[model samples]
Target: MNPIAANKAELIAIADAVAREKSIDRMIVIEAMEEAIQRAARARYGAENDIRAKIDPRGGDLRLWRVLEVVEEPEDYFKQISLVDAKERESDVKLGDFIVDPLPPIEFGRIAAQAAKQVIVTKVRDAERERQYDEYKDRQGEIITGLVKRVEFGHIVVDLGRAEGVIRRDQQIPREVLRVGDRVRSLITLVRRENRGPQIFCSRAHPDFMKKLFAQEVPEIYDGVIEIKACARDPGSRAKIGVLSHDSSIDPVGACVGMRGSRVQAVVQELAGEKIDIIPWSPETATFVVNALQPAQVSKVVIDEEDTRIEVVVPDDQLSLAIGRRGQNVRLAGQLTGHQIDIMTEAAESEKRQKEFVERSELFEKELELDETLAQLLVAEGFTSLEEVAYVEADELASIEGLDEDVAAELQSRAVEALERRESGYRDARRALGVEDALSEIPGLTEEMLVRLGSKGIKTLDDLADLSTDELIGKGDKRREIPAGLLASFGISQDDGNAIIMAARQHWFADEVTDEATEA
Candidate 1:
């Protein structure tokens, strides 16, 4: 140790002060100062050049280690020393032996101080980045509350306590708005560690958010009394949640609805007025489907278990309600229940049946000496509708063991003729009943215009039946030209118009008009 070397106690104090000021660790500062001192010492003392120094901050003691090398001559100032100097530094020093010498100094030049400061800063920054990486990498998929710092390009940049998260525009719920400085709580969707920084991803539109919200709001769900089986949503529009209960005593729907709809309302408000329909889930496919189609009573639900399809039947009045406005209600129901739905009305079914009858009318008229069993089979196959049998495929009929293609074709042709005859009869009946087509042809009859005509006691085909074309033309009503032109266009004989009118009067007058006449 040399007196001019430096004060070790004073050097440790200076390094400690520098570490505290720069927010760098004291050990970092000590290491950096020691390296700087060793560089200066090698420049001064060319003897054993390998020299290093480190300071103990608490004890204020200096450690000295020498680097002794075996060589004929030194190559670098800091690395090698002459063999004579190496042996002088270490008595046992031999060829290729290494030594360490610690050098401590209190005084530092401007450049040295700057170099020391840079080293300490670099070490601390690297260590801090490693710490942050370790801390946040394990926090993925957790929930966190953060403040909205700014909105850029429709993305919400949230300032979480230790990191920032980006919520993209598409992830945001539709029709919802956010403001700066608002406290938003979201689930941490991802945590990515990169060399630059840790990227935290959070989401407000995750399905788990809805599930957790329900669990928080409904005690039945949280306490295991009621369980949420499945959920489907068109966010900010409507959501269908299927719920079941483990305990029969618990009503899942009632629990979700709360008294007067408070429980569901809380969730609705949080979702920005989105509608929530909590349906009771059932294991039976038919019963579950019936329940999913809420507010519309299902008369029947026929399930094809093999195909996983459901056909729903509703009454005539309920059909429109079941299908909903633009089919949105049933569509959501299908999504919730995972089934394909087809809706039908009783009136439509009956009309289909009547049309079938008209088509098949000639088949019954045919003197078919067919076996009773064949007739029964045809009837069972929906052939009662003459149209259905008229259009029956020959190959299909031949596929039946007892039927040949020629018989099928004959049956089809006869059934088709019968259907045509039935339609003609129906048309005649319409004319005889003073149907609007007949009246409209009689002229100047817009439904509204004819309604006015009816108001003036010029009602029905028969009332107009008694009057001639010339009589109508000369009557000089304001609508004369139209009436004359329309009457001529109808191209009907007086007898035909009169007969139709008489039939209509008899049919319509008996029940409705006769009673009204009596009352009058």
Candidate 2:
């Protein structure tokens, strides 16, 4: 073969090799070469020329051109040509037509060759980075095994065959040492396209890492016979998984634990001996919470669904065990159950109940002019509020051991009078706070609610209307130091709060309609 043909074959061979090595399209590498050549030609000829370059993909035939526009009169001589002169190149040329003028091949100098090579390298690298990002972006939540490439600033850089992933310091299992060439498995938590390249962030400390490990060890999980519903981890210390089974015969916890603890042990080893608790998951929140706090006997569980909180009562001796070392057990249980758990001993729970009982009895005695014995009797029968006393069926009250119908009637009358007096006091306080009477006209605005709203500087209809339902009645964020809704203590539901705000804004709509009428 001649030297020119040899060089063309070599060019095609180089493009093939680059495409294979970079795992990019052969067309992309050829395009990069074209751009590099075009840049070099522009430097050789003139920077102001509209130069372009192209190479045949089948057999590397290089070509160069200077594009010029046909205009009535050429102002930019390098890029624009007169229509009369354009007719010499092409008889059919018209105004505004773009024509390409063929040019000779460029002989690259040493410096120009280096600059062209740099352009090609940069383009190929950018294409490779884009391919890496696209390949791994959807691979998040997957478990990948990789070799530890290096450690930088306590973060582990892993070689994942096609890409490099980073396990941040906080994402690694605590106290677990990793060295170069160590085989480690991690969950792909994030894949971000950054200026440098695609950032594949892996995590061994995430709860899903434990779940994925279980999925690997337990075939039942892999086949969808059992599913991991919830997981909580304390890094290298301990982890808990809540598993559920679709098939009735397959017990989720037992399947995850395996025969004689083989499956769970495999996962435990991978996690650096992080103890694993595979609990059977339940749809009932109480049942799930009870199972999550394992090894500790629980006497009772009181769940406040509105607050997403649980009060757990355990035996006095099991307090430390239920709470674990530094409250790790309860904390993991809370995370797994998705509830704020408060654990207490049986004695403490009893003391709380007694305290509430005394407070309610005293309220009845003071508000109803009742004797201590009668108030205690009312509390014992589950009548804890004045509203309950005033609104309860008269027959139910009369059935009490020491109360007749006449006594029940008198008790209800006194309860009503007491509630009215309390409401009057709240109204007086609300008025003193400069709250407008217009706020009282809105539905769901009670004297007590008005007083609370006044204290929060929501004394006018516009102020109340400006608030969202969540802001009016949401259980505020404790972490953010945001106070709870003004009517949250009153147990106002979300629907009620929305209705109240809409009612407050009714006047605004009325004013709009009135102005429209007056203009008409």
Candidate 3:
């Protein structure tokens, strides 16, 4: 009934109201009030004093204390007290003990009340931000519906019930107009904790956004009967999804498309009229690439797994359709299949094959002193390289039409001689480039590879060892104009490159072991 008792009751009521309005814990508000009181007490008492404040959550009874350490020597008079002096306050006080001194409650002045209010506001805001972050951090990749709060610099700010999310300009569906107060659904792509607060970034243009939409529309996807293996989107224009069915009876593409195209239509509408292609996913890379380039019939698919590239040969009439307008179709196919796709007409593919045939035949004729007819015959029988002829089973070569065992033996002898001459030439070229013989001793590095490395200024064993596997045999970034690796042209695998580098570094380990043994 007194003024102090009435103030305590009013404090408890305020804390409850703030906690409810902010949707934060009541204890957090009480703690914020305690901090505010502590700040005010510091202003009232000397700033040097170690003052702390506590408020009873149940009764709202405020308490203030000066915390001091008991020490043999009290250098900081406000924070430390001598053991003898501390005993005057507490009989059980010992050196290095932290003890609190109770202080009289002071009435709040106008300036102190304003400062306390600011502190409470700041603390409550910080608690609210932390709660929002914790609540939404795990909600990433989820589809969230919100009202369009505002637009700034082409970015959409959405009012998610408990938090605000931003749809960056690049994350919005192209040419899809959204106005204030309109309901919008987007995928929570990112949640970042920054100095300002937790940033919730939403996206309607991302491929995952379409996949989530499909999950909502298709019951099979939601229940895990069907899985979205891969997705690629061109924003408001078109999108492709590779779906796989766990249950064979339920076709993934059919389930996603739904009866009468209802499910896909729903997703298409949500994505601002984006056309959706629901392709059945395949485990085989070549089959998957062929499926990804839908609507355009593909005659053949040649996949280079090492480079993650696919070459599709289509009918000349379907060339424009296969490549799409402005190359969008092939680009989306590449994205969905995770491979770089090259589309060529059937005629072009045939022409390329003929050109390669002639080139191989000419190589055999020039290198092995073979007549044109025999060299052409060798190329036709799939003998593309000198090494293949030299190392292949003699019976296999003799089994070729019109080639007896004696002819097969003679051809292999010529191939071996030609390979040896090439190796000798490359060795001389490598030495001329100042490449160390130690480099050739590395397991995977041949004389030709050493010449390439030396031309690139990688002549020493240490220089070769210092290079990464990707640097040794990577298909370099074309966009960045980076040259491919020294052994890239030789079709060296990543494992081979790694083995070569390790072999080059073997001597380093040997020297280390020898030095340690010498020291011992």
Top candidate on lDDT is: 2
lDDT tens string, model 1, 1-520?
2212447676667766766664456776667566655655554554445666656667756665666557778777567667788878788877777756555444655565555555555655565555555676787666678899999999999988656788888767788898999988777777787776677777777656676778888987989889888787776777888899999888889999999998899888877788888899999888888988888998877776534567888898898788877787788888878877877776666676666655454445453445556666676565655666767677876667677888888877776676777666655555444455656554334343344345445556666656554443322222233554234333344454455445544545667877898899
- Per-model TM-score, in order, reads 0.53, 0.89, 0.89
lDDT of the structure predicted as candidate 1 = 0.68
Candidate 2: segments with Cα more than 4 A from true spot: 1-6, 96-98, 392-410, 453-488, 491-520
- Candidate 1: 10-residue stretch with minimal lDDT: 472-481
Candidate 3, which ten residues in sequence have the lowest lDDT sum? 475-484
Tell me, by TM-score, which candidate is best.
Answer: 3
Which stretches in model 1 have alpha-carbon errors above 4 Å?
Answer: 1-88, 91-98, 105-141, 304-309, 315-328, 340-520
Q: Name the lDDT of candidate 2.
A: 0.90
lDDT of 3 by residue, 216-282 (tens): 8998899999999999889999888999999988888888888899989999899889998889999
Which digits, one per residue and each the tens of the lDDT, describe model 2 over residues 298-412?
8999998776779999999999999999999999999999888999999999999999999999999999999999999999999989999999999999999999999999999
How does each model score on lDDT? 0.68, 0.90, 0.88
Backbone clashes in model 2, listed as residue pairs: none
